[model samples]
Target chain A: MSLAATAATATAAAERGFLSPTGVEITFVLVGLVTLGAAMVTVTTRQLVHAALWLVMALGGLAVEYLLLTAEFIAWVQVLIYIGSVVVLLLFGLMLTKAPIGRSPDADSGNRPVALAVALAAAAALVWVVVDAFRTTWIGLDGPAQGSTEVSGRFLFRNWVLPFEALSVLLLAALVGAIALSRKNGGAAKNGGAAKVDRTAKVDSAADEDSGTPGASGKEQR
Target chain B: MHLAYPAVLAALLFCTGLYGVLARRNAILVLMSVELMLNAVNLNLVAFDVWIRDTLHAGQALTLFVIAIAAAEIGIGLAIVLMVYRNRGSSDVDRLRDTAERAEPDAPAAEKAEVIA
Candidate 1:
């Protein structure tokens, strides 16, 4: 009896049974719930600013989830990019668009019922499929950190260097496009204004290209 | 850890984003929903990377790439939204119907006549 008990215990330990719930798993679930709740509130909130704030919470919770998953570099990058810049950009967008400070009631469209039904159906199908597929799958997080800085840097530079450079180029292109879109149609307004607009566009693109790509690429180090 | 947790979470999050995208009237809110969807994809990528432990670490690499792409997308999206708001004085997605088909019988004929002229 004693020998069998010892054998069973060892086997269970080797198996890393997750039904019992490891510490990491528990933390992950708890954080996931918070993240989901925040996300729900973000989409459902009446106040525009509140929605953006709730988005910050949801995204910050995701960053924590990344940390829990042992992707420390990605976690920090998420915080830096999503929380730091993206949320701020969204807030700026809200303010620039003149979103109401208080409740504006028409936040949701007329097709909300249809939207909810579609989302529910999608969720059900996706959950069923994912759970069925990954029911027995397990992630063994026992060894050295898989997503540490050195490891990410190694694979990033060794294999993904070309794509990394290409992404930076893409970012540069996006910046130029943004400048083009945001600049007023000065040319259409006044013919002489076209030269003025061209010079300003050049300056704006140069400034953005000089400062923006590096900040994004620095954290987005793939 | 069981792979179902992150997978399920990501699926739900993506669905929530989908609902937001379809339901939200404000273009900025729609953009927010898009970000949520992208984040869900990133989570799924990271979880799968951790699960498979690929020699190339393709999942995490792709996650980073997705993040970068998402950033670029948001910038361009916001710029477009801003220009739309400036032009039309409102950022409501449903209100923008410049390209929508007209229900009137003569509208198409009139358009064709203009084209012919």
Candidate 2:
């Protein structure tokens, strides 16, 4: 009787629905909720850096969805790029800008009501379409072989070469443009007497001065 | 488990991201919101890819490229933001409206001051 009980227990463990398909479904719901909430706050947050941080949460949730689908490569890429680099760049921009660190009216003004309505309408339409298109469709396990790193690499280098090359060129152009823009802005601010850039720099510089050396300007905290 | 699970998650995420993009006034936050939207798109791609077995990773492969482009975009975007902060002072994207009206070469000196001040 004990042997039978033990066998039953083992079988139950193996069949634990939480570890099965049902588990994946529950996780999907929970992650979606969290991602949605974070994405909302990412835009609503008053602080620039705080918004960027919330974006990280939203991006991470997407990664989780990728993992649930067995797209391991895409999952990792999501983490490495969106969370790792994209957000960091956003923060860097926030830091460099002269926007009020505490509370700036300029950071919180827009036609929010209209925007919200439009966004909601668009989302509702998209959901309706997607749901209609695949209402009763079921996933077929035997459809395609799961992607391995090797196969992914081969496909990228082989069939998607044009797009890949185009992306690279786009990035290069953007890089050069960003550099030129930055330099030009720096010069323009000096020559044209812009207060926007200087205001942010002043606050940062003031903070720097208070901490250690006084009367120094534009020397950022290390 | 229903395939609708991941789809719902992606939709929710995308909606929230859209709200952020529309509501947030901070430039950095706007960029972050854009990232959020992109991630939501990625989620949809992966989920659909999973549901469609015949395609065999096409969706996921596209997602990888999206991630790569997102990374590069962030890099250059950050550099631009940093520069903007240096010249304009604050990162409030709303203040950028005036500059957008005036072409780059013809942007007024007072407009720059208004942003930094």
Candidate 3:
């Protein structure tokens, strides 16, 4: 259906020009702006947990972009996998790392100016190239929904079966790793500090002793 | 929808992630930046899938695969970060510089760095 629509646009180019913005285009741009802003905040926030929360907004905005494009299955999957699990897992990681509850002054490294310059340069090049290349191309969302469950599952099982199986194997490997983590946790529950110190002795510098504890090594470097 | 919208958005988002990866101090925040980059690519994939209308739906399928790999990667990455924190008692990416090129021609520092690793 989208194929037909693209073909139709060849003759109907005048019907949908860039000057005449569609509702979907307007919504996409607005959401894209919000997503971009949230992403900016996620990277810039001083508080560690706030970065994770803002990441949720950025990711959710992308999910909305998926819905606007009429890729229903991908949209739902974005919600389920990204928002439901990834962000929560990130929060858990922050907690496990004992991130500062209040704003940590040294959230960003000293190379922030360099990072900003590089990011801006890259964004400029990419946006310019994309807009110049695809100025006339159009995506048709009016067709029978493309990314429905039936379509995704069928294509996945048929054409993408091998990669799908390999992915499952990878998940199995992750599960095993998770189990190892739990067992390690249980063992470390007792004398965890001792185990950590023993490891730290090998990994950290001997001079680190003159410094504060190893936990403060991060700040010491800062 | 104009194809450029998603394409342009993906490009901008990817760059934002690049900045995050470069500027963030904590390893976990770096990982978050990596997630942003991955999500931008996923958005691009879904958009192209809708636009091209391929018979096999390769774009969406690939997006799913990317998501799974990202999950596994984050798990392993966190494990490594946690291990670093346990040994060094910090997750700062800038600190654990045991193997950095020695400025001085001192043999003892090099030897110590070698032993620590």
Candidate 4:
């Protein structure tokens, strides 16, 4: 390519926010910072439900980053699945458990020095590997053209049908497993007779309700 | 022969997420860390798909599948954890060390003390 043509290509890349241009560069930097901050909070938070919410922020930041890169479909999937479904399921679990809304002494570990050392070692190794692998290449902002839904749909049905079917079967098995696990067999065995079972069931059910309902204190904070 | 900006960012995100997975003990926090790692992988796949200019768009298509699987995994994992907590009253990682810890006759009187220690 000629010098002028190369310069024009660079300008176009910069305009698209993929390069270090003035207008779009700041946006990418800000988004990256926000994403990192949210991720840090997600890991560090003591409250399980609050951590899940922070995860929503982190995932949403990722989706925003995807949109900036012009991958609209992936961004929407991130929001729909991560924010809409996954985090909600997590909250449902937290609510069902007897974990107190206030701090749980069991939430943190005493052996943090070991965990931190392992984590730091893992992070350092990964950074080194990544830097070594992608040191010289400069990828441009222009992306592929075949990212529309139709193309993806066709590929899913035609080439990758078996793995897709397997995933469905896995989901069904998980549903059955969840039902079996939560069936209250222990309470039934403890009762041995019907009336005792009924009383025990009531007590268990009351506990469940007390935990599941967010309560007045929680509602006020929210 | 060059790494794209998205690919580099994805690598960083994934590595940090991996560290979180290794470090976090809370089951819910572990799930969130796993989600972060998945998102990082998704970013790399999408970036590479765009850079290569392939006709199939395989990377983007696979990312959609990854999102679906992640949702199911989190749902089922949390449900299991909740059930476990209902049975045992706690989700602490070290609680698994003793088989008789939750509701067993073999549990000692000082089991709680031992757990705390």
Candidate 5:
């Protein structure tokens, strides 16, 4: 082959390699951008409830990213656990605390600039480290999907069973501890005064009212 | 595809969460920030799992454990925050500085005893 033809072929091959983004990669980038935006809103929103809602979006986007990455099981688990349960739990906590439904000026501190600076520095360092470490690595898409439930389950049960059981215990302990902590300040408050108890009960009822009409109605039914 | 995309995304998410943790006063928001960080870690784990091509899927298994731990953490954290709000009427971490106040009254007596001893 002529040198000119050889150079042209080589250039064509390089162009083909560089310019083609697989559908999965494009989807990944789009989902990542969406997730990032949602995360930003979750952090910066003035409304506490809105932040929680935005968090749902962020978590949901992560699930979609997982799906695009071909981790269907992990994606579903992310959806089921993080979005379905955790966000609801957070909303419950919000209601239980009687956090304002609208804008919460106290949500943000005066340290935003400092925090931003630190965050930017940290992010830069992390990205640099990760990209530098794995610059040329490519995930094989043609092989048996490594992220399936069966593979993950086998891996978890076979090798990680002990830690998995330990996690169950930890979860149980956390559940009990949470119940203990959030239970009414019974004995401590009883020592104060009947009037004080009544005032607290009234405040609790008022907070419940602010949560929603259903909660208020439930209290009345009780 | 390179692993850098997801890794960098995770880094950004983690940094945003860190900023939220540092800049937010609301205890619940802080917990949310913590969730963000945990999610970022999960992303990194899965990305690395795929990049390294571990047949055992060890990274995803660990990610599962991390998720479980995160759930537990949030449960206990939100509970503690609720208890604090119940007692103090606000979830602002700044206002909870008085927790050490109760121990302050005994400090002087202890110091005096120490000096005498």
Candidate 6:
């Protein structure tokens, strides 16, 4: 090509700036906003169960944001693990602890102003740092998708197989630990079998009271 | 497509989780807040992975590991919290401050008297 033709093409390409906002970018921003709102609600709600449900909304919005970013695999994983499993686990914790179904007085400490101030300060600092660091960077959507499952799976197995396997072991340990911690050992006693029977009877009465009045029994113990 | 957008969103989410951790009294709520923070970190990883155009996808791989770790953490944390509630009848963080028992005001004097006797 001639020098003038080469210069013309370079100028045209330069004019097509990478940071130009498009429909996808607009949608991304909108979804991010919704996710932020949901997250805020998740943390601020007084009802523990409602907070868990709002967490689902926040996580779902994040999954949508991931999809918009062309990360389909991570998005689905977010759905399956976060929305499906994690939230359910949280709900189970709430139920197992007999947490109050309505507004919980203990949900918020008397430090809202302080917490809000700290949160705002930290958020501002983080936003400033990230924006300054990546002021003009953009991802090209025309290339091969970077977050496909096959590519991620290959990358994970090739370079990160050790950590992946270690994570499974950690999960197994956590399962064992959870069961051990939550089990009611009615038969183990320091003072022999008679003491064990007494302890079991007391525990059974407490359980009956808890069943009759849910969280009220816990409150009375205080 | 701007990296800053997702990065800033993640930051905001993180700060919200921080506030929840610091200000909430319920251990379960605190655990939920921790999940929020982890999700924020995941968002940051994915955002950077896309921006860097990393062929190896190291960022996403780390994010997967993080998710697995988070699941494990929640499992154990909830178990401990449930155990605490079962024993104490309440999961309030403020109420679980009996880790170190305080000496009674008269304990030292009583001990000295016993020794002298």
**Native A-B contacts reproduced, model 2:** 0.63
Candidate 1, overall lDDT? 0.83
Q: Give the DockQ ranking, best first.
A: 3, 2, 1, 6, 4, 5
What are the fnat scores of the candidates, in the order listed?
0.68, 0.63, 0.70, 0.39, 0.64, 0.67
| lDDT tens per residue, model 5, A45-69 | 9999999999999999999877666
Give candidate 1 regions above 4 Å deviation: A1-18, A186-222, B104-117
Query: Which structure among the candidates has the greatest lDDT?
Result: 3
Return the TM-score for each candidate structure: 0.82, 0.73, 0.85, 0.73, 0.79, 0.79
Q: On a 0 to 1 DockQ scale, where is model 3?
A: 0.52
Compared with the true structure, what per-residue lDDT tens digits does model 3 show for residues A8-84?
75445446788889898999999999999999999999999999999999999999998898878888888898889
Model 3, runs deviating above 4 Å = A1-15, A181-222, B106-117
Q: Please give the CA lDDT of all the candidate structures.
A: 0.83, 0.65, 0.83, 0.65, 0.77, 0.78
Residue lDDT tens for model 4, A11-93: 55444433334433456557867887888777777777777778888889888877766567778878888889888877777
Clashing pairs in model 4? Answer: A137-B2
Docking class of 6: acceptable
DockQ of each: 0.41, 0.42, 0.52, 0.38, 0.35, 0.39
Interface RMSD after interface superposition, model 3: 3.5
TM-score of 3: 0.85
lDDT of 1 by residue, A1-222 (tens): 645644544454557665688999999999999999999999989899999999999999999998888888899989999999888999999998789999989999889999999999999999999988877666767778889989899989999999999999999999899888877432222322332344333332333432443344445543
Q: Lowest-scoring 10 consecutive residues by lDDT in candidate 1 chain B?
A: B108-117
Which 10-residue window of candidate 5 chain B scores lowest in summed lDDT? B94-103
Query: Which stretches of model 6 miss by more than 4 angstroms?
Result: A1-20, A184-222, B100-117
TM-score, cand. 5 vs. native:
0.79
Candidate 4: true contacts recovered, fraction: 0.39
In candidate 2 chain A, where is summed lDDT lowest over 10 consecutive residues? Answer: A213-222
